[model samples]
Target: MLSWVQKRGTSEHRTGLETPLQGPKQRCWFVWDPMGIIFAIATWALVLSGAWVLVRDLLIPSNNVFYAIANGVVFHLLASLALVSHLRTMLTDPGSVPLGNPPGPDTVSYCPFCLCAIPERVYHCTVCRRCIRKNDHHCPWVNNCVGEDNQKYFLLFTLYVGLMSTHVLLLLAIPVLRSHARGEWNASSTVSLPGPIFFLFLVALMGFIFALVMLCSQMCSIYKDKTTTEMLHQNKHSQGRQSMWANIKAICGPRVSLAWLSPFHSPDRYKVSERHVMA
Candidate 1:
């Protein structure tokens, strides 16, 4: 892929998006765009920076060994899960249709950009330069498109990030709240947050807000049997059966299990027999 990009050079207008694939490429799913790569790196940098500051300024300095150890363990665990989920979402194939695949039963129209016939709910991601099945949207944060194949990882990413952020915020806030309750803090008491702590607070707050909004949106999309792209385009015709639980199971897995919460687990594969077209 890198060699292919180098051959095309950067001066080309659309580069990857406009150029149709001449042949079937290997299954590596990384996006080669500069912006996406930078954003992905920044995401890791911020997560690591927050962890370092939290450990240095908040967790290690605590007087109680048990308190520090417990919080540190929980925070690191959640952080690890969030990062792993993000990596999985970024690297996993998001159900890309075969390049230049011949028209079939589900074919709606040919994508000029990808030179392939795409089915219902399929959309072309310019960044990824592929027609993704049930493409939701291209997220620079994860540096990939969210679609049928990897929505579970995207959801898990948001969930774990939200939990970790909330945990950090609560740890930073509770002491102040307790002090105010005990009358140790007053309007003129002039308690101020240190620079590093303030920076950590901002990071946690941003992560929490972003994760909460995204998680809620993804949940609603799943329940309605739609993608973010479908919602935005107002494509309301149902592509599959309308059972909420069934849709959830389809994205998360075949059955309810702890694996649903795991980034290591892949979602149940979508079988053609399980899908039907409306007449």
Candidate 2:
């Protein structure tokens, strides 16, 4: 709800944001933001590295047009989706607390720093320097606070990345099998695979394992209608399926199936207002 205002008598709109002198709910940034840069560099490095290996060894050299094209299509598609989602998550406003608004009947609390009505599930992120609606943990890798507005994007990014890693691993298997069948590959020769081939296999495996663990953890939190922050403190609930699904719809939007692959908004999503249970 907090929108930036322009400086009076100036044609330029105020650019840099400053946290007001509110309580702990607001904080002035003291250091440079390094997360976004690190995340972007790491993401592209892995993706490009994997693509080079796959196309050079498996996709192109295989001389199978259909296989190459199909794998290329799927791989690049996932990478694009993942990259786009990551950007969306990083750049999006993570549901700010409405400033100077009186609390409604259901809103009984206030953010100490922002002095805004506190709805259920909203919390303050010191790193982000604001109170976020339905606040999830501030993810360093994405370089953003995961909140109601961008949680879906965060999850979709994770899903696509995990799939990308797994798919690359599958692609790596072909050459590995051939080498093994011909008795040309041995444990000692693990170091002898082409540089790209070895790098792709190792990176893919590590990526898949890391993403799988993170994905499973996130899924559990979503299923229970809880965030990792809440889960860390042992938050538990016995909400009905409908309630849980409502949380899903909140994050995944209405068209759950299409939502994962695309960034289009569905009609049903508009009807849903922002809401979150306090941690």
lDDT per residue, candidate 1, 132-206, as tens digits?
Answer: 877889999999999888889999999999999999999999999998999987668987899999999999999
Off by over 4 Å in 1: 1-25, 275-279
lDDT of the candidates, in the order given:
0.82, 0.67
What global local distance difference test value does model 1 have?
A: 0.82
Best-fitting candidate, scored by TM-score = 1
Per-residue lDDT for 1-279 in model 2, tens only?
Answer: 322211220222143322221223323222135875686568777877777777888799878899999999999998888788777777766666656534443343566676665545667787776677657688777777887677777787788889998898877776678878999976777545777788888888877886788788778877877777767766454231346676677667656676455644422443323343322
Determine which window of 10 residues in candidate 2 has minimal summed lDDT. Answer: 4-13
Off by over 4 Å in 2: 1-32, 178-191, 236-243, 255-257, 266-279
- Cα error of candidate 2 at position 48, Å: 2.8
* TM-score for each of the candidates: 0.89, 0.74
